[model samples]
Target: MSDLSATISPAVRLKGVSKTFGPIQALKPVNLDIAAGTIHALVGQNGAGKSTTLGILAGRISATTGDVEIGGARVDLGDPRRARAAGVVAIYQELTIVPALSAVANVFLGQPLSRGYLLSEGAMQSRFAELAGRLGVSIPTDAEARSLSVADQQTLEILRAIQANARIILFDEPTTALAQPEREALFKVMRDLRAEGHTLIYVSHNLDEVLGISDAITVFRNGSLIETRPTQAWTKAQLVTAMLGEEMGDIYHRRPASRLRDGEPAISVRDIALPGAIGEIGFSVRAGEILGVGGLVGSGRSSLLRALAGLEHRSSGQIEIAGREVAWPRTPRAARALGIALVPEDRKHQGLVLGMTAADNVTLPKLRAIARSGLIDNQLAAEVAADATRAFGFDPKRLFAPVGTLSGGNQQKVLLARWAFDRPKVLLVDEPTRGIDVGAKAEILDALRAFAEEGLAVIMVSSELEEICALADRVIVMSEGRQVDHIDASRAELSVHRILNSAFGVERHHHV
Candidate 1:
């Protein structure tokens, strides 16, 4: 018997599930059975077909050939509505929460309560509030979801799933942007849900979280199931090896700081303030330096990056590039012209034009560079994209594929490649490695280091403290939209703990 077959009965089963996109066999005769009322974790490196499997299960996409059974009954999951009706719900990494809508409204977005044909807003509000309270969250039901933090948004998404009476909930890297406390709360909620007999298929790159929360762990590699073992039977090292099909000694692998003789600032900011929330903020970056911005969700990390990218309306601030003070550019074009580029955190919505091909997406910002006399040079554009793809180790065969067709890490790589060729003087990257696997994270950081080595001022914003500690030459901590502290890489031990302590307002701060 297979290792997975010995553990639990199948609550949801997939038999000979194979999904193909053109030449790419995303899933190859995959067999999966998620046991009922248990937290089952699906883990793998990028492009390992984890999301594709979830998409199929969620009915976002159909399998080429397979049978999906829920409780031993054959299911034709033709659409998401069908999946939901069949007690399946998914909280995707790229959130589906409507920004303009209220929390209650989003919770009951499609399946609103109705009394005699009228929407029961009051009932929805009361139920939402109750759910929120139970989840240890206090987000106002009437407040716009856009105004809520990422953690709140994620909670709302999960609540929606619960409200829909889903027996099997699939979480696609749900806590990628959540703060520590919020993540702890989520883990608690998951534990509570498990006690209440709900099956959860937790997908995440954070191995520790997966191992801690899951009963059974399944590893996928290159569209195939490698090993599906009980949580108790797996070691972190063994699991890491199975996921990557290779041993990884240290995922972080922080290199020694290179020699520096710093006299000039590559980028500088002074008296930066924005309307509503962002208060006085100031910082600077030297050439070949990585500056990390650390803060809890909604603490203005994204806002600061946006302000630097010229996307946000900066109320009062002076930005200087290589000692020359300049006005903040209102348009992205202007920012690009001044040699500044941004990799926005929300990749699906902000980073890539999903409908376009990978080549088209990569060459988007540099269209003019590859164009002549108001006419786009297709050959030149393809060449540029091809070169970038090769350099980034992105599959060239997938070049003609749509940007949406790629995995999270590949999509992120495409985003980086686009900006790399732009040759921006200063690179403002937010959440550069969010939701991607360990190997991909290492590669992305390496690429960033290379970029910095070429003398580009790189400013990165990440909630992951370890990533900051690994890649940053200097780290800045923010709390409530204000810069609280800055530390050099040599003092990472001191800086990381101090930053976290500041983030939590802990008095007993320990550096390291």
Candidate 2:
């Protein structure tokens, strides 16, 4: 490892930096320095100042007060162009690839080679080849970006940064969507970059990945810089405690098995299949049970949830409610009529109406129930929303506030409360509490448990194995499109490793 304490000037520096929007000071004053040619990491829960600090450095958002320095010299990276000019580039979570463009064209997108105001395609291809060679990555030069894998697209972004002569690069959640092998490939590229004397700043919520790639880690919380330590000096447990002021285990607790029921399952399904998504699979859940589905990124976890919700028209399945067989639900309306509700994956797009108020969103499913004389009762709607969301710790006074104005935590609460407003028999949630802070996570999980205790059968899908191990009374692991392993926490101990092993490929199934 390079000498972190060496007296050389830092490649990036933020001195007394702070950012605010109106009355909200999103980031408090922070002083941070990233040493030259080292992998530095920034970690925090949602609303933490880590993202704000990155924004100031990236020139995406200006800092309210303070100075930024590059190479010991003050520089004005006030916008994307200026930041690029200063040799700073950011690869956001959302890949910037244009689907129709080829790999060669994407590398030279904004700043392309031109000879006397005429595009120089030959020169661009030559430069692209050189950068690809430097990075030791093999991607078809003329391949359409949309056809490439996520890892290949990221390599194209890296080539773009290198074309701009960027010596400092920021990666935002770089490996969240990558599978195990793909993640290792990206890590190798990052290590190569560090060896070539480039400075890298990585931001991620996955603590294990953070520890593996970072030379040093900095923790941020509630708009303040909490602490910074060398990688070896910090444990995963320590990092969690610093980030949330609580141990990792404290944020998650196993649901008590005693709250479950002994009678027949509230809902059971057989032969769930959706084209190339999920293979024929089946499971059952009692009235007071939470069954979690765990798998890797494309392991059909969300697909299964969608199939059950009647969102996939091409999907075929056999479903039974309280041991009564019924025809498969092929439409959302049909599913709802049968007492099955789905809280979709993209809460902003597929789930809630952002322009609507919280109370308005909550009563959306059964709006007619709140109507009288051909007019909706605003007072009744507000009262109903307040009562529904109170169980999830949402502020009742904000019921009239627009859903867009609420935090991620509150928005999730709205989605859950809205779907469960009329009390469905089975609630299918995709990535419950995703993008929510660690602080709000427990409350959301507990609320789901409380609902299960109320005799509501819940089927949850989460990519995070720790959540599956903690919140699910039973877990069914999926690999590719097939069921791999089944575990009953009530009968056996559950661990993240066991779930991951099955997800990676063990191919064992337990009948419904």
Candidate 3:
């Protein structure tokens, strides 16, 4: 362990940390020492105790047996306020910004400046403008937080934490919601924060960011710290091996061209138009083929998926399945009836029921199929959930456990299982492996490949060029709500620069 205790005086420490919920031992006795003014990257597989550790640090929950020390002083952070008072700020993946409120209001939240008792809008706006400029985020103070793009919202949140003058910041998959350029800006902010002597505990699934940003890395496996190593001491392969306990070359198992059966188009879209932005957008997917939807954050990638899944009301468009023509589906159920399932990008909000059990979530989408005599067939639901758990390698003993209790990767698997269990002819999967561990990532990709091998069509949208390149047989690049170019995955060299170039065009590379 290189005597981490001797290397640097810890800004925060967790000694003999142990936490458990019900029958699940979420975290074991963990010892960690985070130094001052350094970005510490925490890496682990899904359900590997990453979030649990962060939760303890944030004071959202307490450890069963352990001591939390800040600045070499023990702190009883019984609540979030105490944690904040102790200079600990956590920016979780599940954003809590109020949609109806302005960015300034959301940022200042309950701690807004006040004269006597009334809120000071003028003071708040001035402070917000100054902070936004400092953060290099161009969010309008008066604009609703929800109206802003994901990148802007994330920036606002970071700025909020900084404004609080938090010395220790915990970023839980903060960049997962951001696009490339936005992520770059956030990285700059992290560097600046480090320069200002702020301690950072960066939690992310993107290994590239971890390699580029972190000074030291900590690996956790199944609720225990594997080891902590300096970033210079490891390579990508070594890190992957450490995280997965195996050698993983060729993370994506790419197949040859999809089986073209004369005239069968697995999925087809014609002249699809949104409320105001997109116009005459058209695309198609073939059996056993993976299509990549590449675009900027608001370039209508998610909207197009919603339109395909019949969740959005398309003004004028024709959708088809199995070469037979079909009009725009009215509801999600209607789309599912035609063997179309969508795994939304924001899985927590749009996909899974957080409070429901894993088994319940897996069976929620296909209740009609699993029901008999106007009642849900419990036995059938259990069988389906069990089969999905086995296939996805999710722990079936935790089937009755709440989806909220599961890690990001397992929750994602439950969502995938819900949709995949339907045996859809065409699957619309968006960001299948966002904010997850490497091991779970491989397993998810394997499931997708297996589905494709069964002649099921898959269309995936992701901001990660590596993931898109790895999974998709064909790539469709979108910008400004337009399909600019469709590249053959076989020809493209699967480089970050190439995919970024294709996504934003040659002119935009300078900005990127």
Candidate 4:
């Protein structure tokens, strides 16, 4: 089957293509071919140029050099209209469905049926039904897109592409918000598409999904293509190694301090529960300690943090601070009054105002401290934000820049720095190094360690197991909204394997 792919003409090919933004090379020159009727996956660490390559192919980005061919025809690489006309379509994580529009209207959004400027409603509905039937899926044509489930909405997007006669479809992290059954359904759809001869380019961080759905997998590292191999020829560990490159230990970052041990209890919770999200969760952490919550997606790790932050209204818990009983906080302001601060998972929507300057975002939590009687003292705010973030390796110059323009790493730095002004005793971080490059990951991890060094009890939730092992002094593994096991690093058994076993509700193995 692998050899057969080579003989069949490639549906898409890149020859010596590269991308650069200002002085930074986002993608190095690369030559590759994506065969027709195959699910090809592109995987790498964050900022490894997979998205850049996809942008060039989708005509959203102009390549700095080289040529792109779609079905043996050279393409004008930076025009979206040309890409669409050439049968190339990109389905992003953020769906393009208009909430108020009916399903059929969304499918034929800009290109509706018409007869001499008169709407042909019957024709549009029939085409919607036809496309849905051809995909072996069903979505009510008259129903509003907002009323549909996320899975159904995604299926609607695919139907839209199919309606446009898209021969090549690109999916970027399609299953990030999907449940197990929805993911399975989407996979079935992809398989069906392949069977009908549509080429797919799948980009994801989820190795399991990539392994299961792809015929071929390609690894990218530091703007370069590392390797491309059949899905059957790779293991998760091998994929990780390839993404990091051989002899690339220098990129790894983790240093848990010895002084973070044996501190007094800073925050203690008993029976924390969020309805439908997390079961009863209870734990304690010292003032200078970092405790990690490890779990699979939907295992209640994030819900636990949300409950602690007082974002979950139905969450009920008994909490104490500094060995003193404190009333359980019901709102975020109440949590702040209790000296608890949560740096939420969705930074764009929940954490920062993207249009605001980084300095403004950082000082937002404690405007009172930086403001005079009537108006804000801008100088004081800037000075405070600048001084407090140096230890985190954030630049003072970027503080004046709008947070939206900053890279993911810098935006995260701004988010973390916001907590400094208010100075919480307990800090909650969700996916601290998510969507950032290796250099920035190290800076973020170091900032976290710095926070611990400053005597703040930090509770972190990380999907990546290695991150848990690196920065966590202790780990509490959760599965299905309940704590399954606890492993302290002091016991010399807090490895990724033991934690993973506990997350899966298996017995922890003793390391030899």
Q: Estimate each model's TM-score.
A: 0.90, 0.88, 0.91, 0.75
* Backbone clash total, candidate 3: 0
lDDT of 2 by residue, 1-512 (tens): 12256686789888888998666677998888889899999988766778777877788989888898899899987997888899999998778999899999999998899999899989998888888888788998999999999999998999899888899999987885677788899999999999999999998877888899999999998789888888999998889899887776665777788465688989989888899888768889999899999888888999898888888999998899989998898888889888999987778789989999999999998888899898999888888888888888786756887787566678889988886678999999888876666666777888888888888889998877777787788888888888878788887747887787777664344534
Q: Against the unseen true structure, what C-alpha lDDT does each candidate score?
A: 0.84, 0.84, 0.81, 0.84
Error of 3 at 94 (Å): 2.2
Model 3 weakest 10-residue run by lDDT: 503-512
Between candidates 2 and 3, name the one with more favorable lDDT. Answer: 2
Candidate 1 per-residue C-alpha lDDT over 308-333 given as tens digits, one digit per residue, 9 for 90 to 100: 77787555588888899988776677
Q: Where does candidate 1 clash, by residue pair?
A: 493-512
lDDT of 4 by residue, 366-433 (tens): 88888799689999988999987776678676788788756566788888888876789999999887
Candidates 2 and 4 compared by lDDT, better number: 2
Candidate achieving higher lDDT, 1 or 2: 2
Report the error of model 3 at residue 494, Å.
8.3
RMSD of each: 3.1, 3.4, 3.5, 5.5
Instruction: Give candidate 4 misplaced runs (Cα > 4 Å).
Output: 1-6, 77-79, 113-130, 133-143, 226-238, 248-263, 270-282, 291-304, 310-318, 325-334, 355-414, 417-423, 433-454, 462-512
Stretches of candidate 2 exceeding 4 Å from the true structure: 1-6, 246-248, 258-260, 352-414, 420-422, 433-437, 493-512
Per-residue lDDT for 81-127 in model 3, tens only?
Answer: 89999999999877778889988988898678888888888998889
